[model samples]
Target: MPPLSFSEGFAIAAGLVQLFVAVVFLRFRHGRPEWGLGWWAVTFAAAGVMNTGAPVLLAAMHSPFGTSLNVLTMVLGISTMGALVAGSRLYTGHPRPGPWWSFALTWLAYLSLMMTRQLWPGYESLIANGVTGLIFAYLGCLSLGAMRRESGAGHGIAAAMLCLYIPMVAGAYAMGLDQVELRYWSAVPFALAGLGVMSAMMGRMRAHLRDLNESLEQRVADRTHELRDIISSLESFNSMVSHDLRGPLGGMAGLSGVALSALDAGDTERARRLFQAVQAQSSNLSNLVADLMALARVSNVALLKQPVALSELVQESVQHLELSHGEGHAQPVQVAPLPVVACDKALLRQVLVNLLGNALKFSRKAARPQVRVWAEVREGGVQVAVQDNGVGFDATRQRDLFTPFKRLHEERDFEGTGLGLALVRRIVERHGGRVGAESQTGQGATFWFWLPATETPI
Candidate 1:
């Protein structure tokens, strides 16, 4: 065994360092969709073998079979080039590398060509340099294609910079036989530059991963906050239902017992009155249950949307309201022509029905029970409003008016379950719209909703 020279020793050290880098990359990560770094890891590892041994082997050693070192060097160069090409393609989102056998067959051919050179010594330099040049040219052209396509950051930078150095490396290696001392050392600079660019690319990937982690954390936080709010809302809803139902249930129970006792004592009139009270309580309970179900459906059910002409819809809703309230049909409805909007027809019909009903109910005492239905064009949508000359509520209590089982007027004054407006808001919002109302005490109230003008609903 012989000791190493200066350049050979430097090459050996660089090769070991390259191997260390390869090991680090292999340990880094393998879960990415783009596996360029994975291919790159293989690249540095193979390169480590060439750098560490190629210099000494070519300069001093000989195969027992008398094979020239040129054969091995050419094969290694092309193999390294093949890995680079595959990695770049993957990074650029080109077709992924083919089956392992495809690469294996390619490697076998390279090895076969190297062996062929040993058999044909006269044209050996031509075979080796020519083949190696083709490999570099293929790599250079691939980099150029990727550059034109504007591949990913890592691929783009490496291609853009390393491509410029490819010709010099190929030219230097092509003259390897003539310049024995310079050929191996000449390739070192370009290889080092390529490795540097790869490191930059890997650094970019690390930064991107950090950004992804931050984004994931933010989404988790947002979801946690939303979950907490939903839990609080459920608690409040439970409390409201329990408190509201208790009074009516107790009244119905007490009224039933009283009516039974009155019947037993032979008091027909008292029994009839007590039974009527029980019936009213039963009706209230039924309405509350119906409203609760409607709210639940509104939250859970998917919408079926269609383009609705508001003018015809308003008239139809008004007619439905009039028929439902035979006496309140006297409340004349004045409507303005409105735009076409995309919405869930069934839900929008219910919204109009509820708004019109409120208008008629609150204005029953007016000299002329008149409800005005109108609409206006607005940015991104159309806004339809239902206005009435009625006993409007206080502005401060407006927010509470839409709450489930919250009635602004007494049952003796105006009968309702109070889920009407709440249901309206939920349905409208689900359709990507908004509902609001404006009123002053004793003045007319105008309840309005904005429907987006969408060509298609998804």
Candidate 2:
């Protein structure tokens, strides 16, 4: 109703500012309780309400009611301090107990004393100011320790402002200054402390964003490397198809023309021989295509893993090899107890067949050719080895053994499309395993693979 003073004008503006800050904190606090923004919002809201209400109530009610408003203001001030401290601890990841009891006890004690203010009148304001100042000092010390725990500009600023506020309150009280004068000096630092809190929250959010970006960048890098490897493999496959398939197709075409000429010249036997040569070439091409299909299948198929007895699979492979090649039936294969592994049974069977077939084929030249299959369990899982007593290859070139169409032996001595080991490698890798070979020229060779272990025994 009356003209407003400078301190009252400042108090109203500061209260509005604090209320606006509380609203902003509330808006950002959604789904982020860990940030402690909710507590900060309470701190500002309570301070804003007390600051705005105290002046209006003091003007309207000049007697005991006015005195009661002052006590209420002090009580709310303690609440704001508690909320600020709680928010600070939560933000820095060092939480403390709730300030409800302190608020309740202070309110009850002060209210009881205020009822008897006629007897103890003047001392109440001093006591209230002193108590509030001491608490603020304590909170400042807490913020100082928190600043040391976590490097943040906000904590330091809040501590400095709170600590600075104590001396101002003490000086004002000593000079017997009124509430409006006290509010004038205290409002600036209070507002700054709120800004400091906001700064700490912003810094934390920035750090979180930085970590997320780094993780995303690392994922992108890994995916890029994988895509590059896929491209390289595609290129190698195209090269092999062009070179290897063209030769066989060309030989077949040439043999067909030559046989036609022999038939025209009335050379029946020559024509028959040429036709047989063409058929052999056609057979080789078919085998190569089949191997290529298998390799592609291995790359794309999703694995269905189950416990399988690898020893049984090895025996079946040996029997099948004997039946298919005819001569390898005489080769003695010594099979040791093999561990049971979790894998796709069909794919794993194919792996055993290729490995055993190669072992028998390579070692059949020995006077007493022998093929040995054994397994060992190690820290890295189960390793199965197929060794042969045959003419071994150069160990230095062993890495190339699993490459499609890469061969160490002459075609005349050994018959193969050079894709068996490559297929073995792919199948094993698809099962989350690895394949390798060890050998020295003129000695024996050992081909080994390892698979993740299962609970099943040998």
Q: Highest TM-score among the candidates is held by which one?
A: 2
| Weakest lDDT window of 10 consecutive positions for candidate 2 | 96-105
Residue 160 lDDT, candidate 1, scale 0-100:
46
Cα lDDT of candidate 2 equals 0.80
Query: Candidate 1 lDDT, tens digit per residue, 370-431?
Result: 88987777777778899999998888888887666677778789888778998889899998
For every model shown, what is its TM-score relative to the native structure? Answer: 0.62, 0.63
* Stretches > 4 Å off in candidate 1: 1-204, 455-458
Best by lDDT: 2
Candidate 2 per-residue C-alpha lDDT over 1-458 given as tens digits, one digit per residue, 9 for 90 to 100: 77877777777777777888788799888746876889889989988876666567667568667677667766777667667766656665665454444445545655665677678676777666666666667677777886786667987898888788778877887898886689765876787777776776677668778888999999999999999998997899789888999999999999999999999999999999999999999998999999989988898888999888988888888777778878546358898988788899999888888888787788878888888999888665788899998889998889889998899999889888889999999999887889999998878799999998655456
Candidate lDDT values, in order? 0.72, 0.80
How many backbone clashes are present in model 1? 0
In model 2, which runs have C-alpha deviations exceeding 4 angstroms? Answer: 1-151, 154-201, 211-229, 319-323, 326-331
